[model samples]
Target: AGHSITTIEGLEKDNKLHPVQEAFVKEQAAQCGFCTNGLVMCAVSLLKINPDPDDQEIRDGLQRCLCRCGTQSRAIRAIKRVIG
Candidate 1:
């Protein structure tokens, strides 16, 4: 297969957190940490597809990643922060 793969770790460079990662941290989006990776990855993908997605679009984009710790609101806020 000639496909490229990117994991959450690949999002960082020069010891700096990606904007999405920084936003998530700033918003306190990770509660239990279990779903953080998936959420971050999904957010990255979502932004790649729609750089200026609205709130509803962000929610729809993250639907596939489940965060059982109830950090969805903060995560949404984080995404909005990245959007801005």
Candidate 2:
């Protein structure tokens, strides 16, 4: 296994959060936060594939990750913020 992996912790550099993380925080996208890590990871992966995804595409990209805290709307806003 010669694959490189990046976790949530690895997304930070120079004490600065990644754009996605920053957006998430700014939007208060995490309520309970139980699903925050997964949501963040999914968002990162989605953006990697599609840097400028539309609202529906963003929804579709994050659909696989479940957030029981009802923070999906905020998360979408955060992703849109990153896109902008």
Candidate 3:
């Protein structure tokens, strides 16, 4: 048996943006965009377990991700948008 995997590209469905991806775009969450994929994936995983995490919880969950382009705040906003 094999676990399923979904990359950032895999988030699209039938040529449309997944809600999470739409949220990211609406929030302008990426700067250089280098960390966008990984961050989005992490957010997806976190939201799955905790659909409505608080600000601190969201911060704690994404602490492992790094973005030299300084998009952390917007990334947090993006995740919140999807959760709501």
Candidate 4:
């Protein structure tokens, strides 16, 4: 699978965040928030490739992320809301 890596700083124009980032904030999903941006981007990108992924597929998508934050479930829920 081919994927493009987009940094948190590069996700916008005029030095602003993308809407997905904004949405994550709105959901209050950013506790500590250290890994929030990367998690959000990863979720968005994965859903674009596999919109209706099963639980195991979602886990596979996140396998390389190595999250320290405990917001994984929230991120997965957001992706499912969009794609499912």
Find the candidate with the highest TM-score and give its number: 1
Off by over 4 Å in 4: 1-5, 9-19
TM-score of 4: 0.64
On a 0 to 1 TM-score scale, where does candidate 1 land against the true structure? 0.95
- Number of colliding residue pairs in model 2: 0
Alpha carbon lDDT at 61, candidate 4: 83
Rank the models by TM-score, top first. Answer: 1, 2, 3, 4
* Candidate 2 local lDDT, 11-57, one digit each (tens): 99999999999999999998997999989999999999999999899
- List, residue by residue over 1-84, the lDDT tens digit for candidate 4: 797667777778787766666656656667666777667777667777987888888777876665667777776666555554
Instruction: Estimate candidate 2's alpha-carbon lDDT, on a 0 to 1 scale.
Output: 0.94
Candidate 1 residue pairs in clash (backbone atoms < 3 Å): none
Candidate 1 backbone overlaps, count: 0
Question: What are the C-alpha RMSDs, in order, of all predicted structures?
Answer: 0.9, 0.9, 1.2, 3.8
Off by over 4 Å in 3: none
lDDT of 1 by residue, 3-68 (tens): 998999999999999999999999999999999999999999999999999989999988998777
Q: Where's the lowest-lDDT run of ten residues in candidate 2?
A: 61-70
Question: TM-score for every candidate vs. truth?
Answer: 0.95, 0.94, 0.90, 0.64
Instruction: List model 3 lDDT by residue over 2-80, tens digit each.
Output: 9998888888889999777788899998788788888888888888889999999899878888778888899899988
In candidate 3, where is summed lDDT lowest over 10 consecutive residues? 60-69
